[model samples]
Target: MSVFTEAEIEYLRSQLLARLATVGVDGRPGVKPVGFLVDFATDEFVIGGYVGSGMAASKKFRDVEANPDVALVVDDVANIDPWTPRGIEIRGRAEAHTTGGAEIGERLGSAFAFDAAWIRVSPRRIVSWGIEGSSFEFSARDVASLPTSKGV
Candidate 1:
């Protein structure tokens, strides 16, 4: 009962960059397009949430704690042309960082294109995947959502 097929999930995991949109304490939805790595060739996303100074990066983390349910979307920008690659949407839970998960920061530090740290997100369910012509979708409750992971 998932929106994305096996191939779609595989494609998501293969991609290197995705937008992590988090709600700040102020209830504002903060969106940042960043790089990520899918470990074990699965849905285990270990990332770095480091970027910009005092931009309130921790705001996202606080949001995650306040609301564990999160949306992790990694999609290619749509171009006017028809032949460009399509985009993907993944819905999942974000694990807040801690002293133990600091290692994930280092792991994603080099894998990502950015010089700052990264935050890990585990997709419990995929919401959608498609190009300009078509699209597919899924949800966390759809298939029991993604299991709690260690990446965060």
Candidate 2:
């Protein structure tokens, strides 16, 4: 097993969006399931105005405001694609975007709802495993091999 190949990285971005967001509040940690839309164009994950944004998302925001450290797990539960039986867990810091935040300087986040912020993955570490048979693993760094949008 190795780090995510160039191809696998993009596939993961294009295929899966169901994410588990971990947020800690009042010294108690919680995991919330949420639907995220991955934007390959800018290599960013966006969450918008939706009702079932898991539990304590707003609270999580407050938590992030207090503590920037966070964790994320994005997976393909159906095993439908080549990377099927594979999931990636990212451990990194997180920051909540205010109306006039630096990166939030754009309108993308605030577009859909009052809380559309980008989950900037700092990529402290990446671990991917093969869920199919048993003996598979991968570790990937930056998306160096990712192709840019030329015609598309």
Candidate 3:
């Protein structure tokens, strides 16, 4: 079962950037733009960034470690005249994974260089808007109940 409809999945594939939000150990909120991929097989979002250094050594990574709760949003402006906005927002638990040779890294392929860490977000709830006429929300159970396509 797929959490996203085929059209929604296609929209995600077309987008390159997503905003990731995390809560710090001290209870401050942090958000940053990230290069990401949707891992359909695992139904998770994957983000990779440099490990051993400045930015990664800072709050966002620490926040994920201390608190796995996170939210990611991927969106784009379709038209300026009509003031149209569309995107998907995902709420999930995230885990920091070893990089430099992980499956997420391979899937990302050239998005980042060597020595990066992966943040895999396992989605618990998903909400999408403007893809169709109205917005739709899906829980993990709703996603699980979707019928699979034949000939997989």
RMSD of each: 4.8, 7.4, 5.4
Per-model TM-score versus the true fold: 0.64, 0.58, 0.80
lDDT of 2 at 75: 64
| Model 2, span 7-96: residue lDDT tens | 546656555354545556667776656545544444544444342343235676676676766666776544455444666676655645
C-alpha local distance difference test of each model: 0.57, 0.49, 0.71
Error of 1 at 58 (Å): 3.4
Using TM-score as the measure, name the better of candidate 1 and candidate 3: 3
Off by more than 4 A, model 3: 50-56, 100-103, 108-110, 134-152
Candidate 2: list runs displaced more than 4 Å.
1-4, 37-44, 50-57, 78-84, 100-119, 131-135, 138-152
What ranges in model 1 sit over 4 Å off?
A: 1-6, 40-42, 49-57, 77-80, 83-85, 105-118, 131-141, 150-152
lDDT score, candidate 3, position 94: 82
Using lDDT as the measure, which candidate wins?
3
